[model samples]
Target: MTSFDIVFGSFLVSALRSATPLVFVLVGETLVQRTGSINLGVEGQMLVGAMAGYGAAALWGDPWLGLVAGAGAGMLLSSVHGLLTLAARANQFASGLAVWMLGFGLSAYYGAGLVGRKIEGFGTWRGAGLDDVPVLGPIVAGMTPTVLLALVVAPAVAWWFWRTRTGLVWRAVGESPEAARAAGLRPIRVRLQAILLGGLLSGLGGAALSVDHTRTWAEGMTAGRGLVAVGLVIVARWNPWWVLPTALLFGGAEALALRLQTADAGVSAHLLLTLPYITSLAVLTLTCLRDRGQAAPAGLRAVMDR
Candidate 1:
């Protein structure tokens, strides 16, 4: 009824929409970090996935197939990193950066030419059942199905990381690679699996943003959500459970910025837009200082030499 109430209601929905990509990236990053491998090319991965996903969807008439193709693309890119980092014993940071740059070049080359190429018959989440709820309409609670999928995955990921036997091995590799080796587990193998899975999930995040959420292919559509999510993993102390809520918090700040701009409050839009990233930076810096010992993975180096 009131203008402020309407703005606040819209903000919540917008926050949820924005949070979906963050949740997807953080969950995947959570597993990779837990297994002692680091990838900084998430932005690149998402961009590539966006292009690949849209291309696949446009070809297949089924968005689900596009998502699968997108995920495969992500895994392929990450597998290269896993080989370089774990097998060749390359520096994780450097190798990850290389991957990022490679993706950057490839995406820009392809994305520019593909603009306005429509994907006919791609399913959209805009008019699902959620829009009918009196309190949970599009202005308040209507959300893309990808958001629901991500919310479900978050808890499942937390449970798997903390409670399963495979998870134990995953954690062991992160905490003590030598111990994991001595325990009859292959460090390379465990880390490879983690890397692949992480990349897959992240790619799905890209797919969701490109195909399901926006239903369009824009160059650099993912923006920097992937990188922010890497910080989210660090801020959550590598805890999958906590990553969900932290993502929501960051998303909320973003939603507020968008609302303020829409309301034309005379505030600079760029400043409001930077709030989420700024908040993530503050959280990461504070978490690093306050929970140094607890925040880092067992053997993770700030800069991996080998």
Candidate 2:
């Protein structure tokens, strides 16, 4: 009868799990945005990552290998985009959308026979002698590895963007590509690295959802989480540091909806599940009203921040 206790305790776990994927995706998007480009192919990239990770895991029967393969898969696809935009001088948005289409179509084709496939659980890793220190027991208990990574990555990403010289150049490229180039920083090269790293992070997010979260794979499993991550970039005002809390907000909503389903709220469950998307739109609408649609980074050339 203690609803508070139930939601408080279980919500933490659900939040951790649900937020893991979004954490990775948003952070990656933040990195890419820092370099002044947007990749709308996030949904498609994530879909391909899911298919690749599940397929690799299923075939090799080893989850770690599968995860690595998934990352590689995403990198390969994204590198192609980098080449087109960087080397070939193609329009960034158009090239990204093409990559998205390629990932979606390819993943769907290969995933046709893989739907409904099941995977073994990725259970918690209990700390051994040192990590079991009494003072820190609560800190690490019951946390999936990605959750820990999510926590640690906030500062790492910040350092990558602000403290490092490369980071400075990267931001410069985003804010003013021509200026960056005049300063002897190769815009295409920096952008390519940003794009590649973004793909890697996004791939990890897909792995968390399919392998760690549900332990299953299906067509369209990404379900627009990629798009949500892109939105997170805007909501966070293209700040890597802001992605953490914003990701949790989205994650918390999703966890609440799932919990409602477990409580057998039926129609209400479905409604709650749909709220995150609505919330995203609402957030955009509100931000636009205030900033007149300039919540995103200035000088960042991309398509469809709206």
Candidate 3:
């Protein structure tokens, strides 16, 4: 291939790698919001998952086990949010903030010693048969299993939301919890399930970051990706399918920043790093203005209106 082809192909690969984690978190948060609740603690959940996943992998010599640990850690943190919001009827925003703080503190304390540790994390797939198929083959071969999973998750969630009985009930609860309750559906139960599921996905996102992408642990490594996921969900208007492109947009910006930094393109390194966040903010702002909350779930509107 030509030099330009190689460069462009590399950029695409990097964008996919960076977008993988966001895809996971976006789907998870989408589910939670669909149930008329929000988990602002996604940041904390991701951190805790990262620490637990890396620590477990390091201790057990298995990345799969680390992934399980990460999911569990994220779910465990979400349970606190569920208790506060569902059972105690606490302010959702306040409860979510508390959950985030708790997660942040716990991960930092437990993961302090894990810094600089290394593990045999997930490796890229080998496109043995398709290696000669040009750009597509090379990109597919460069992806790890987690990247493939993230790609599947977005569409799977979209299908589940629109094509299943359970999904309809969840959507019903999100649109009007009182109506759902009167119709013999339990809103609290559904919301709790969504919260837990969301946490699991968030954890997986964190694990993908440390075990699949970085292959190492670091404090605050998530760097507000969780918050970015939250904004992307808004940009997507709660539609799982839209998440794919929006996430790729953020990922591509991040990849470009990294490429520029390495090429010493005469820009400040710190400024370059802000490209992802800047892209997210710009898209989110535009989406908000266009949507004007017209697409928000009614149940979520009630909670936010308070």
The alpha-carbon lDDT assigned to residue 275 of candidate 1 equals 90
Instruction: Put down candidate 2 lDDT per residue, 117-223, tens digits, no spaces.
Output: 76665657455543344434433565666677778876698777888998888888888888888998898788889899889888877876776777788778888
Indicate the residue-level lDDT of 214 in model 2.
Answer: 72
Q: How many residue pairs clash (N, CA or C atoms closer than 3 angstroms) in each of the candidate models, in the order given? A: 0, 0, 0
Least accurate 10 contiguous residues by lDDT in model 3? 125-134
lDDT by residue for model 1 (1-306), tens: 555655666677778777887788889988888888888877778777777888888888778787787777777777777888888988887887887777667777877766787775343345666455554455534565677787899999899889999888889888888898998999888888988888888777787777776778887787788888877788888888898888887888888888889899999998888998898899888888898556677766544333
lDDT of 2 at 30: 89
Runs of candidate 1 exceeding 4 Å displacement: 1-9, 120-141, 301-306
Higher TM-score: candidate 2 or 3? 3
Model 1, C-alpha of 222: deviation from truth (Å):
2.3
- Candidate 3: tens digits of C-alpha lDDT, residues 76-179: 99899999999999888888889889988999999999998879888775657655667777778788888888889899999999899999999999999999
* TM-score attained by model 2: 0.88
Clashing residue pairs in candidate 3 are: none
